[model samples]
Target: MSDALTLKAMLRPKFRGALLGVAVGDALGFPFEGSSHSFMAALGPDALHAFEAHRSGYFPPGQFSDDTQLTLATVESFLQEKRFSGKSLAESFLPLWRENRIIGRSPGCSEAIERLIDRTADWRTSGCEEGRAGNGAAKRMVPLGLWNYDEPERLVEEATLAAEITHRDRRAVAGAVAVAASVAYSLTRRDLILGEWIDAVAGATAPISPALARHFRDLPRFLSMGEKEAVAAISKLGYDDPATAPTTLVTPFVVPSVMTAFFWFLRHPDDWRETVGGCLRSGGDVDTIASIGGGISGAFNGIEAIPEALRETVVDRDRLIDLADRLHTLKEAVRSRRGA
Candidate 1:
């Protein structure tokens, strides 16, 4: 196959893999969101089992949460506009918020999007100072990276715009930049060493947040800290009380959660089951962690790398696949127009 064909072939599977991987990871971790690791350990070998062991009524077994829902919306926006635009993002995001039933239940997220829709506040200055930096921004950034896979700088720029729609805080933007950069780097280069990939992400995200910039700068040292210790270290970097200080507390959680997930996938590159499972087992912000991990792994391994059972169970799998294809087409359109 020609290089172009090879690159295009890689796009479909990575796109499908990234979205489906997120759904699978989200569903796997949904049942244990607030539960402690010890409680999960009490469940025996299959500690990270599906919803059968943990009940979430109305939500189907493999259904995703706000993470995948927002991601889908972002992908849809890219398809509609062929490039990232804050106004277009807000237009696309509000409907998904209502359509996915994310409002009321997820107050922080709902409030953010609602404000954008109502024009009560500009996305650039709307985030709550007390709002904890949950993984909300990072969870939805895969599409930005996937949409501009060939242009790492554009991926970072677009991902930052997508993130600002809901999370305008510096920390929130930093987390999105890191994840998006990772995805873009993974997509463009096949032979990247894991540490080198992490470094590249850190470098790309340097302008977003000093804390995040520092975190990425020293990531090589942290990589040896092991998953549990690393998570604990990350959790400590900020208060986890989302209700008390939403932005201040949450930013800490998202940075480490995204980093931990990326590292987990790096450690287990070939095993999708273990990679996704390790993300679930990492605890605290389970869905977000898994979403990040799944996206990275899926980007590196492709759709076929994901398990058959998990892939089949993703809510709206066909629709997500179609969306990915549409995003790819839009990307090509943008490239063609720019060349013209």
Candidate 2:
């Protein structure tokens, strides 16, 4: 095959792998979200050992909550028009909400989605307040990145619009931009070094919020702090703390958690078990962290990089993979048209 065809072939599998990795990681970590590291450790002989999915609080095990559901909804909207649209996304989201796939115990997301359904609230203004910067929107944006792999700028723009459908906060938008950029960067580079990929994401996201800028700037310092110390530094900022500014809290916790997971994956690039385990051991925002880490790791290593047991157990695995394949086709079509 020609170099172009080889690259194209690789893109599809990477995109599929990345999306499935996110869902698998999310489902794995879903059962232990609020539990402490010790509590999680007590469940198995090793950190990544399989355990029964939690059924107490929200959705059932092997069933995705808002994270995977909203992601699928966004993918469905993208499929309808080959692009992201806030109105279309809101339309897509309502059906998921009606089906009870988007339910979570998070009050912020619940209220936002409810108001969006009533049409009483503008999706554009729904999360403008500083305190609305949760990881909800960012966690579901991996597909946007994959769909526009050759166009980092467009990926960021489309991701911002997709995020604004329910999370209009600048921090939320910035987080989506960062994650999308990371995926886009991963797709374009064939032999990406870990640090270079991180730098590429930082550069692509430079135009966003200053809070994100500072996090990227300090990323190396935090990386040097070791995983335990890094988690400690992040925990000091607290999660959903009403006292701290929303931007500040999210910047410290969400970004650091995601970055730390990526860093650990980079350190253990060839070891899927260790990479996902390190993400699970990171302590807070477990699902989001593992999802991001898994996406990056899967992109670099391909779908075969993910463990078969986890992949087989992923909720909606076939649908997610099909969506990813569709997104990859859209990406190539757009690239071809632009070349014409």
Candidate 3:
């Protein structure tokens, strides 16, 4: 059944769900990040769903990595100024970088933060804007759609600016637009068909770069395939760079990480548990793929749909909820000003 629940007036729960979902997904894959498929398989499904017991030395089991940290930072930027500001978003990152909180730094993002601190380069110029595209731009963009759900053009403009703080590649900007747009639509559109949803995302994204155009072009074939088939197909597409020896799935490369995440979410949209756990099961960059897929699934299904078992394990559940509520109240104030 299509969700009859009106979403325009009930953005709080969905917004909370989206951010909380990101954290949940990030935590899920954090332990298995960079592990080989054989390693993950040996860990088994029991380990995949195990909470508060991460093998990875970096975090305390349920704790999320830089993905959720930056996502929360993005939410904070809006709350701090009572509105969205790219400079604020870029500024928010510096503290994390300086505090040694970020798990691994994207060169562009790190450079942007450094430049922001020294007042040497503007956020626009400080970005490591080589032709290379990476996951840094896309991993933390969930809050952009939550804040500006009503405005796609504005979302595109704002998201691009925010992304340029670290990743200037047109492909990175395009990928961010696609993720933000998908989240934007979920906030309002209840009867979302899988194909049309991706088409809308691809349409908005493809115009920005040829690389993403090709990536999006190949996405639809997975629509009708089984989960295993879709995974295999994505692997064959070879979105990751081959030159990098011991190429881990948790690559900073934008294209494969995105396609892999989207394949899992699209495969099982209705079940939030499987959607997150399934992506982690695929291994390699487990946290980021799960974060992207989990956020989207959470936005579509609402936090209520999340299994209590999994929800119980998420780190800082109340804090995530509070951040979402703050964004909701701020969004309402903005609406009141316009008096729609």
Candidate 4:
């Protein structure tokens, strides 16, 4: 096969799956963003099947939130520059904020973009650094994973630049590295070994945050527990309180959100519905959690693994697939130049 065909044959579906997975999961969990664990759990098995928007009609069904908006913004910058540009990426986020179109915008992300738009901070200095470790940066990093698949060092560097635009806390940057690295690993492997995957992500993360690395390493132990015990343990990742509530929802804090996504993805690696739906029911930042989990599972499982109904209903389904194709094309070009 020609170079183009070979790369396409190997990567197109995975790219499509990863990007589409993020959007579909975001759309599916958007309705339950602030819902508590008890509320989501009370819905039981039906929660897995439910995919829609918030009831206020603020967003129609199938629309995604800022999690996906950021991802698309990242991809658009890469496509235009043919490489990651922190300035361009920062600029891309501005229109969303200026137009008042960003749904479910987190405070950290809102402040970062606001500063950039007002010229109070440049791309390098704009990140919310006052111990802000939200998952905003990590959730939109799948494109960096796709772009830097064969360049681990470059991947880390670019992931940092991409993340620090809105999240400068080292822990938050570590979370971004973990998510993007996981996607790269997923694309490279035909089959996933849970322990090996965890080790790889942990190794990549440790250089930035040992605490987050420890959390990644601890995932396998949680895997050994039954679902209820596992959810209880994982849900407490970033918190100190011992809860009396029926369940504790996963928060937007980087540690718990990333761990929750990883836990669910590990639990149901081969089942698309289970992986993302499990994140959905974990509650709290449901959209971001499921979107992260969905990206990993989709990269591993490919586009065909996602349910047809969800694919049909997700906002910007066609645009996401097109972005994937463009990313794949760019990946092939970059790899060919590097002789990778």
Let me know the TM-score candidate 2 reaches against the reference structure: 0.87
Runs in model 2 lying further than 4 Å from the true structure: 1-3, 43-47, 57-61, 103-105, 237-253
lDDT of 4 at 337: 91
Error of 2 at 330 (Å): 2.4
**Across residues 20-86, which tens digit of lDDT does each residue of candidate 4 receive?**
9999988988888888877877877776564655787877788899999999999999989988888
Lowest-sum lDDT 10-residue window in model 4: 238-247
Cα-based lDDT for every prediction: 0.69, 0.69, 0.76, 0.87
Candidate ranking (lDDT, best to worst): 4, 3, 1, 2
lDDT comparing candidate 2 with the true structure:
0.69
For residues 1-340, could you state the per-residue lDDT of candidate 3 as single tens digits? 2353356555777887798889888887776677654565566667545564566465576788888999999999999998878778888988898888887445656766788888988877777675767777888888888878887788888888888888888878887877888788776665668767777778778768767757766776876777655654554443455454233334556776777777777767777777776677666777887898888878877887666666677888888999999998898799779885
The stretch of ten residues in a row with the least summed lDDT in candidate 3 is 241-250
What's the lDDT for candidate 3? 0.76
lDDT, candidate 1, 187-276, per-residue tens: 665565866876788877887777777776666666677756655555455345634533211122566677667767766776667777
Among all candidates shown, the one with the greatest lDDT: 4
Kindly report which residue pairs in candidate 4 clash with one another: none
Give TM per candidate: 0.86, 0.87, 0.90, 0.94
C-alpha positional error of residue 11 in candidate 3 after TM-score superposition, expressed in Å? 2.0
